[model samples]
Target: MKRVVFNQKGGVGKTSITCNLAAISAARGLRTLVVDLDVQGNTTHYLVGEIDADAFPAEAQGAAGLFKQTVGSRKMHQNPDSFVWETPWENLFLLPSSPVLTQLERELESRYKIYKLRDALQKLDAEYDRVYIDTPPNFNFYSKSALIAADTVLVPFDCDSFARQSLYSLMDNIAELQEDHNPDLAVEGIVINQFNSQARLPGELVAELEAEGYPVCATYLSASVKMRESHHEHRPLVDLAPSHKLTQQFLALYDELESGRA
Candidate 1:
């Protein structure tokens, strides 16, 4: 299955969720590929440490290369798999993000290459058991392409009042995208991230969302300093601190998603 972890709001744990979930999937023995479309490259850094810019050309590396190949005379010559990079983890692969994505966006949009990602991923259906896409924080060219390519979208909610208000606008945007671009795309669930059980506001906000009929997943990810340590170590929680509470919550969330698929 192809799943895109998306949110128009930053600091919502999109990178952490995307990388950790893909890591869990890989650990479970699925051939998982993570496509990072965010130019910030947080997902790339999380999976693979800082890349040497001089080692490769922007137009020939990672997601930028994949999208770059879609335009001009270079189109369709390279296999989509050729752009993928291997991470340190077994069964976990990455199509790392590059800063050049910002430069290529206008040309890609002007050429109407929104469906290129979907087409490429379809061709790769046999090569991977699961595909997780990490998108930019805005509903821009990259995020829209990811939404168009994905089978479902997992939204991250940070349990803030401002985030709650933003959720409405985010839902509306997804609804519009579903109507216009990807009719088959589904909202897998709203993952409640950084939940503090001792806090009254978090519970109240979650109750409000559930009462309003949102698809809130039962597994809530708690905030922990270990997550930062995992990031600093450039390791996913499943590999860094599998027995930690946050890691267990991630495992439960992963199981919930797999069960839903089943």
Candidate 2:
């Protein structure tokens, strides 16, 4: 399955969810790949740690290179696998992001290469058991590409009134994209992240969403300091603390997604 974790709002845990969920899949012995399209490269850093500038590929070798190579080319010469990098973890791979992506958006859009991402991912579908894409915080070229390429999208919702309002707009954008670009795209569900069960406001806000008939995931990931620690160490929750409460919740969420309960 190919899933994109996205939100048009920052600080909503998109990178965390992407890396951790993909990590769990790898831990289960599935071949997993993470395509980091965010210019910030948070997911890339989370999976592989700080990059060595001396050994890093040029702007023409990462995801930016993939998009750049597609421009005005009658055929794809570079294999997509060449752009992929191996992570420290087993069965996990990364198509790392680059600062060059910030400059290629307008060029790609003017060249009408929106469907190129979908085509490339289709070529990789046979080789990977699961593919997860981490996108930026807006409906820009990269996010749109991810949406078009993915079979499903998992939205992250932080319990707040403003986030709830933004969710409406995000849903509308996804619906429009689905109609125009990928009719097969499915909204897996809204994942309630950083949920504070101790606070009455969090529960009330979630209940309101449920009352409004939103498809919210059954598992709520409670806010934890361990997630911050995991980030600092560049380790997924399952790898950092398998027996921790938050890690168990992540496992449960993964199971729910796998079982089609979300």
Candidate 3:
């Protein structure tokens, strides 16, 4: 399955949720590939430590290279796997993001190359057991491409009033994309990240979402300092602190998603 973890609002833990879940998928022995479409490259940094630009050329780097190949050509003849880089963990691979994506976006959009990502992923269907995409905070060219390419989408909702308000607009955008682009793209669930159980507002907000029939996930990821440490260490929760409560919650969330798929 190709799953895109997306949210228009920043600081919602999209990178954290994407990388950790993918790490868990890899741990379970699934051949997992993470495609980072965000220019911020947080997911890339989380999976593989700070990339030395001197060693890897921007044009030939992960998603940038893939998209660059489509600007002039009518079809992508290059092997999609060529853009993928293996992570430190077994069964996990990454198509690292680059700052170059910001430069390539306008050109790609003008050329109507929105479907190129989907095309490339279609060619990679047999090579990977699971694919997870981390999109930028906004709905732009890259995010749209991910949405078009993904089989399902997971929205990361940080428990906040602003995030709650943004959720409505985000849902509308997804619904519009479904009608205009990939009808098969399903909203898998809304993952409540950085949830504060002690806060009454958070509980009330979640209850309201549930009552309104939004697909709020059963599992909630708590606010923790371990996640920051994990990021600093460039290790996913599964690999960094498997026994921690936050890690266990991530495991539960991963299982919830897998069971839903089954």
TM, every model? 0.98, 0.97, 0.98
The list of candidate 2 runs beyond 4 A from truth reads 73-76
N/CA/C clash count, model 3: 0
Residue range with the least summed lDDT across 10 consecutive positions in model 3: 69-78
Give the C-alpha lDDT of model 1. Answer: 0.94
lDDT of 1 by residue, 1-262 (tens): 9999999999999999999999999999999999999999999998898898889787789999999988998457789999999999999999999999999999999999999999989989999999999999999999999999999999999999999999999999999999999999999999999999999999999999999999999999999989888988999987999899999999999999999941
lDDT comparison, 1 vs 2, better candidate: 1
Give the C-alpha miss distance for residue 128 in model 3, angstroms: 0.5
Model 3 clashing residue pairs (backbone): none
For every candidate structure, what is the RMSD over all alpha carbons to the true structure, in angstroms? 1.1, 1.2, 1.3
Can you tell me which runs of candidate 3 are displaced by over 4 Å? 73-76
Clashes of 1: 0
lDDT of 3 by residue, 191-260 (tens): 9999999989999999999999999999999988999999999999778998999999999999999999
